[model samples]
Target: MEISCHKIASGKASGPALVSKEPISFLGTVDPETGEVVDPKHQLFGKNVGGKVLIFPGGKGSTVGSYVIYQLKKRGVAPAAMINIRSEPIVAVGAIISEIPLVDGVSAELLDLEDGTLITVDADSRRVRTEEG
Candidate 1:
């Protein structure tokens, strides 16, 4: 299925899907080493984000969130693309600095996407396409 939203960057990628109904907090919530969500209460907790399309409601906590995101990128533990219901400044800054594909203003239905689905994000055109694995 194809859905259009505002894209933070334009790109296509095929990777395992990771969906989170909760917003993520970069501070102390993610493990940069393994790209795993460390927050036990988070829907994606203990899930590896590496090489996956990371989808969440949005970001929360700390202006330094962007720095953490960049660090993850530098460590090669960053998600291939990001989809959010809304874009937070921290996430926006990180996506820009880390050069990761990002799309926001997406519908909550994105949360229904199963893990391992192949999805493409076109940030330039604000589109997201999903196909069966």
Candidate 2:
């Protein structure tokens, strides 16, 4: 299904979804060099977000987390795109500076989608779709 949402960044990306049920604190939760979720307490621990469409509730923790996201992009390990139920300042700024496609105001149905489902996000168009559609 094609879902309408608010655009937080300007770009288009398609990839398998890496859904995270919890909010992410990028600075400590993700490894910039490898794109792995390093926080053992996180449900997504041990998973690599690289090249996927990272989906989560929103961002949490320090504003420095924004730079971490940028670092991931600079290191070529950032998610292809991102979707948030709500876009907070940190993640919003990160996606903007990193040029990663990002959208928020997504419906809860999106969070229920299984991991690895093909997802296409067109932030420029304020739309998201699943491969099944």
Candidate 3:
């Protein structure tokens, strides 16, 4: 399926989709060390977001989410890209500062996208295409 949305950064990315249907609490959800989600109740709990396309509804908690993202990037555990159902300032700021590809306001077809699917996100054109592995 094809979903059209606004992309924050244009680039090619292929990896698993770490889907999070609920809002992620950036303050506690991410572990800076392993670049994995540490929040036990999070759908992506214990899952490594590094090199994955991290998808979610949006971010919650403190505004320092951007800092956390920067730290993750510095640690070399940042996601290849980010996809959100909607854009939140916290997440947007992080994406910009981290220079990670970000797309948002996409359809639920994004949720149907499996973890291991090879997907490309074009932030410049606001497009998301899924390819079979």
Candidate 4:
């Protein structure tokens, strides 16, 4: 399946998708050094987001969440890319500063995707493509 989205950051990434139902706040919800989801309330808590295409509804919480994303990147623990249903300033700024690909306004295919589906986030073209439709 190929889904179109608005480009929030420009880059390209491909990997297994790590889908999250809840919105994320990088500062407290994710461990910057480990890239693990740490928010107990989140279904994906305890899972590592590193090396995967992190998919979530959107970002919530502090503006510092951007730096946390950058921190994750600097620590080599950030997601390969990020996709969101709505790209808010917090996450969009984070992805941009951290050089993580980000695409937003994509929720349809995301809802149907399996946990570990291999997907490509082509932010340069504002598209997310899956092997299966």
Best by lDDT: 2
lDDT of 2 by residue, 86-113 (tens): 9899999999999999999998778888
What's the CA RMSD for each of the models?
Answer: 1.2, 1.1, 1.5, 1.5
Q: Which ten residues in a row have the lowest lDDT in candidate 3?
A: 7-16
Could you tell me how far off, in angstroms, the CA of residue 108 lies in candidate 2 after the best superposition? Answer: 1.7
Q: lDDT by residue for model 3 over 31-83, one digit each (tens)?
A: 87779889898888888989988888888889988889888888999998889
Better of 1 and 3 by TM-score: 1
Global local distance difference test of model 1: 0.86
Off by over 4 Å in 2: none
TM-score of model 3 relative to the true fold?
0.91
Q: List the residue pairs that clash in candidate 4.
A: none
lDDT of 4 by residue, 7-115 (tens): 9999999888888878888888999889998889888889999988998899999999999999999999899999998889999999999999999888655955787
What lDDT does model 4 reach? 0.89
Candidate 2: what lDDT? 0.94
TM-scores across all candidates? 0.94, 0.97, 0.91, 0.94
Give me the runs in candidate 4 sitting further than 4 Å from their true place.
none
Candidates 1 and 2 compared: the better one by lDDT is 2
Candidate 2 minimal-lDDT segment of 10 residues = 124-133
What local lDDT score does residue 104 receive in model 1, on the 0 to 100 scale? 92
